[model samples]
Target: MKKQQSQWTHREKSFSAFVTGPLLSFWRQRQERQFVGKEGVVIRYMRMTAAAHKKAILVVPGRSESYIKYPEVVWDLFNCGYDVFVIDHRGQGLSGRLLDDSQLGHVAQFSDYVDDLETLCELELSGSRYHQTFVLAHSMGGAIATLLSQRHPSLFTATALVAPMFGIVLPMPEWVVERILNWTATRPHLREGFAFGTGRWHATPFGINNLTHSRVRYQRNLRFYADQPELQLGGPTTHWVREAIFTGRYIESIAPELHHPVLLLQASEDQVVDNQAQDRFSLARNLAGFPCYGDHPQVMEGARHEILFEKDEIRAEALQKITEYFLTFNPNTV
Candidate 1:
């Protein structure tokens, strides 16, 4: 099928060029709307299509994220000859907020996200006429995708995880600290807040400076932040951290049950999730005779937490590798 290039304004072009290199060879306009779930929660998504494409890739964003934060990724997937659908996780982006008061953005459990994804897949993507459907998730979204793959293996053809938050790289005493914090957060007087090392609430110009390979790419992301101040999200609360710990443990225990083909992309220099834990999980899955654990697992050197938002060349290469893997596994569809 032939692909068409979507028009972009000068500002948008500058933004895309700064983040994606010279010019985007394959770009498409996106349509945004809400995918209603059970219990009246609306999951917001942005979808882009290629002409005559029969396969679709559903992208799940991480914590404090919105669909607009992933323009580069959406464009790349469109170029790769597949329809791309990006969903804003519940309590983030344009989705339903968790807390009504000051804690509106905070989540009490990671399983809540898993439930949202399950509903999104079954109710949203199940009836679509695409020949093949897959999921591509990053960080926290990666964790949810892993859980979803285990819980609903038949819904997706495969999954690609970028810097998935399977576990944390904390000091030995950190576990004790987390337990104490969790207990304390339940107190009547103590208000819940984020844990240590999470990013600040204010969007700083320097936030992506150190993590990205290109200054222009970082600047472009900064511009997006400047334009959309409301999309900024704070760190996880104490309850969120506690729930994440439990979720990580649960996923680890059930890793053997996942039968869907999985591609795990680990950043060698990731400061967020524990890369060692991801490696160990992959190794254990191989040793335990898991069918889909041996799929291509690559650790990109000098990459940070946000692989999709990295420098133009680096991000493009990473996306290429992902698209290649997807096409190789399911060539009959794409």
Candidate 2:
């Protein structure tokens, strides 16, 4: 497929002040709507108006994330002259919860996520005016995006995965944890307990939290959850853990088959996802004895798992690199 004209530009930094300001009023002006996902679950999504001649970028958030948590990122893309679309995945955010306890994170199958994403794209994005589409996914959403990009090779022009959860760091060995969760996931009685007895419904204080090193951004998230308790989600259920393990392994296995232009961003000091697995996935250059395209891997030294929510300097650096990479390939030109 031939590429189209380049619409990328050196947009100035205009979202510098959004992190500390009130975002509800700003986001209320963005278009919001709802759609029925798998099993008729209601999914909430929003879209930002794009400047003329710009493309669309979809934001796929990680576990326990909500669209409410990404106002700064949305504004950043807006400043970069790209229209942004964001969604609250089914198990978290404003979407319908899976279990009786709304705070418990659970999913019967990981494929449900992939199906929901495909549905969302077909219904919401396929008929849009713009032909070039870009994707920026984080953590668990990165895993989902990896599978989506591979399964539907023509869907996106380019993709950037930040702190992707191709493999996760657990206390026990990966196989051991997977076996335990697999056992628990099948039994109806063991599905309600928190995975590893962590990730409660309430927000952890910033003094002891490891999500981000930036106090300002960390406290801002805490305040968001405090004002909107319904958006607060707790630990994952055994089923959720089991599903994630299987999904991560699957994504790793298919990493070499993906055909899209990819930039895999790694957080050098991350304690969440397995960085070794990320390295292996990024290095895959062969499939079925045939040479394949390898991903462009970049490491952000000293950054934590939440690169977008990190310190001002680190976040700025990551976004700058991401913008530069995406500008190299115009979907219309490809």
Candidate 3:
């Protein structure tokens, strides 16, 4: 069979509305599938195929992101001779929502995301023609990927974490934040406010947004949510904040045991996750004379939290580095 080709390129001078538009006629559209996650929650996913490629890239998106937001990314990978798989985690995107208010972001525990991802892999990826698998995770998804790596050491050949959430950069002190989270999580009916005073189901104007430097890319994403209100979600809940804190600490404990080659891509101007935490994890071996576990850290200067949504020059470089990292480890790469 011949490989499917895409007309998309990362070298575009600006994000093309034609490419990122709702129609998506030029790109191969992914058929949505559902899997039963832990406790019978339904998780939604989409897989894009490259008929002749034997390698696959599994993309795990961050909070409030759905597979629809990543058509350009999927097209880019498919054109580079790899299959692409992306999913909307439970309680976000098209997946099942936890709270009665679908717009409210909520998760009782972070491990539920891990369970959902494992189910997707078993149902879709096991024993497939794509022999080697790589992961490209962003933000919170990066945390999920790291936890998966610690638990299943041999699952992925290599991984790239873009602006991984090792630690969240909150305004208050860590102790005070933890205290508030603990109290709110334990409270039965007193916790419904959005974290950091962000309102429910609200959109920020491009001028005040800190997500990405590219107005074109930012507007494109906003358009997606505007068209499909169901896919849009707001700030994290108290339970979610508590669970994430626990998961972050767990990852730190097992960081020394992770043997997989990981590329930790840190954004220099990231206002979401703590850059100092990423630095500590990346340089743990050098600083403490501990055994190295292939933690390679690369910084994207002047980029914000969402490096993938930044200006074309920055996005291009980041994608190139990610593609190179995966290709280097996949023996089938030509």
- TM-score each candidate: 0.85, 0.89, 0.91
lDDT of 2 by residue, 1-334 (tens): 0111111121113223443344555676788878898898888888887558357888999999998898878877766778898888998998888888888887778778888888878866797677678889999899888788878888988888899988888889887887787688667878766888576677688877767877777877788788998898998888788777778778778766766777878898898888898877776634433222233358888799999888766787788777767777752431
Candidate 1 stretches with Cα past 4 Å from truth are: 1-28, 36-39, 100-105, 188-191, 196-200, 207-210, 291-296, 332-334
Across 100-202, the per-residue lDDT of candidate 3 in tens digits comes to: 8887788878988988888777776778677788889999999998888777878888888999987887778989988887777656554654675655776
Weakest 10 consecutive residues, lDDT, candidate 3? 1-10
Residue 226 in candidate 1 has what lDDT? 64
Clashes of each: 0, 7, 0
Clashing pairs in 2: 2-334, 3-332, 3-333, 3-334, 4-332, 4-333, 199-235
Quote the positional error of residue 31 for candidate 3 in Å. 1.5
Report how far residue 293 has shifted in candidate 3, in Å: 9.2
Ranking of all candidate structures by their lDDT, best first: 3, 2, 1
Cα error of candidate 2 at position 30, Å: 1.3
The candidate with the higher TM-score, 1 or 3, is 3
For all candidates in order, the CA lDDT equals 0.70, 0.77, 0.78
Q: After superposition, how far is residue 174 of candidate 3 from its true place, in Å?
A: 0.9
Best by TM-score: 3
**Cα lDDT, model 3, residue 317:** 73
Rate residue 151 of model 2 by lDDT.
84
| Residue 57 Cα positional deviation in candidate 1, in Å, after optimal superposition | 0.2
Better of 2 and 3 by lDDT: 3
